[model samples]
Target: MAQVLPPLLDYEQSYPCPVCRQGQLDRLILMDAFSCNVCHHIFSVNLSQQSICLADRTPALGWRWARQRWRPLHHPDIDFPLGIWILCGGLTVLPPTILWVMHYIFPPLPDSSANSFPLLWIGVVGITHSLIALWILAEFYQLPLYLSWKFRLQS
Candidate 1:
């Protein structure tokens, strides 16, 4: 999938932010520490166990880094009404495919050349519908939805 934006937080490297307590402590330009986008406070990283606030660091330990893996995290936006993603994907794929199949399987009769106009119209409509669905999917992808390696951290 094409990623349009970098995430606010890198899950493999961050945890629930201690400073803001809303967003995660996202990794900063430096690898050893993180900064919360919410509070704008930078904190140190404790790679051994959990999110720990060192004496000198800002945000300290709460959720620990226990497990991590990379997968497509569903977008919170379109997920509403649920199964919408599947529906969009289906619409993107199914129409053109069906039209192609029907064209091959049900060719126009030998003397029905003038009647093929409707088939052309259907093909154009299918292509337009497919492009619309694809555009919708692209918008979802561009909406900051990302695949992350999330850790099952404990509080």
Candidate 2:
């Protein structure tokens, strides 16, 4: 889904670091740019486009600020967190796959009901695991409503 991001409208605001993803990009004192505290990367801002690019790197790569995170300005097709998606996909698909393989190798008891038991169990477990993985993905992606509510309650 396309996200509506807040403009890098002012330097007074702090943004999440695009490099480290853990630090805030705070405006450097006496400078027209921002620097990430954790990664120590300086970024030059383009107010017109509401994007910021690394000061020492090519300006072709830039990012914009979503409400609680940063979105890449360029390469929209490749902007997701690959590692997280891979991890979540593995978690969701691995266990059921192993279970199915094991079941195939060693068939369940010959009893009529018993034959169906393994299939039912595997289906239930797979659905449960998939739901959990989706939850993890949502949390990691920081869904706006959930994130805002969480912070509000914490405060």
Candidate 3:
């Protein structure tokens, strides 16, 4: 069956730039502000008041100084990757060592499938440990970006 699609609309109508009155919307650069390539102006749009203001040139030195002074004192959140590495390293080494000792002291029955147990146990533990580590690393990697965005908003 043929499906009819809606007509294409102009970019300006579809996505008007929040900063400029007549400029076509490109992409949102930041919250409350957008850069107009055509006019080479950064406009600030107050969503609450529905007003736009051209960005002014403020000295960025003060912000840099503040960040340098505060960042040192504020302990950034714990890095998940390092934490996971420590956790997984311990998990990977400790269990197998204990299991190995147990196996040596109380050997598995000759007829029992005890011979294969350590290998399977180690494999399962290693895989689970690696998966958990990867998950933690991925979650941790996103923290910095989120923290930066949050700090930016607060400032």
Candidate 4:
């Protein structure tokens, strides 16, 4: 009868530091190694010879809570909606509002074009919509800064 060996575990699958397991790592200081906040231990293990190090061991509980609270607003993956909103609002709303004001200020010419009362109403609607969009955008802009500060404090 031949003796059988158990399967070898991959380094990536194994815990780099015995003190801190994978999920318990508050932050990954390097690709393979992490500092354990619970035990305040810094240890290294071989993970593809990257020479990774773990320096700090403070947990970021406040940062984590803040991130969760402002999750919806701090998405870097999405394009900044405010920039698009401002651009489109300016292009679509300003011209109509100007035209509407001009119509009210100046009397119709003798060889007159038709009255633009309909367009004037549309302009008012556009301006109202743009104002609402701007308010929402202002609220979103603060979120990124909040998250960045939180991360910085954590590290």
Instruction: Give the candidate number with the greatest lDDT.
Output: 2
lDDT of 4 by residue, 1-155 (tens): 94332233233332222222212333344544444554455533333432233434344111111211211223424556667677767766776777667666875665657556556566687777676665565444545554455446766
Query: Which lDDT tens digits does candidate 2 get at residues 1-155?
Result: 95443554578887777765656788889988999886678998887767788887764457876555667776643666788889889988999999999999999778666788888888998999999988888777767675556556766
Candidate 3 residues lying further than 4 Å off, grouped into runs, are 1-74, 77-84, 143-155
Rank the candidate models, highest TM-score first. Answer: 2, 3, 1, 4
Clashing pairs in model 3? none
Model 3 Cα RMSD, 1 decimal: 16.1
Model 3 lDDT-worst window of ten: 61-70
- The ten-residue window of minimal lDDT in model 1 covers 146-155
Kindly list the per-residue Cα lDDT of model 1 for residues 1-155, writing each as its tens digit: 93233332343545554333456556667467777765566655555543334334433333333333112222312336346578787886787778777877987777885667657867787778877876676554533232121112211
Per residue, candidate 3 scores C-alpha lDDT tens digits across 1-155 of 94332233211222333222234434354454545543445544444432344555443111111211111112333223566678767866777677777778887778985778876886787677677765565454435554456446766
RMSD (Å) of each candidate, 1 decimal: 13.8, 8.3, 16.1, 16.0
Could you tell me the lDDT of residue 106 within candidate 1? 80
TM match of model 3 to true structure:
0.37
Misplaced by over 4 Å in model 1 are 1-89, 142-155
| TM-score for each of the candidates | 0.31, 0.46, 0.37, 0.25
The candidate with the higher lDDT, 1 or 3, is 1
Q: Point out the worst 10-residue segment of candidate 2 by lDDT.
A: 2-11
Model 2 lDDT, residue 117, Cα = 83
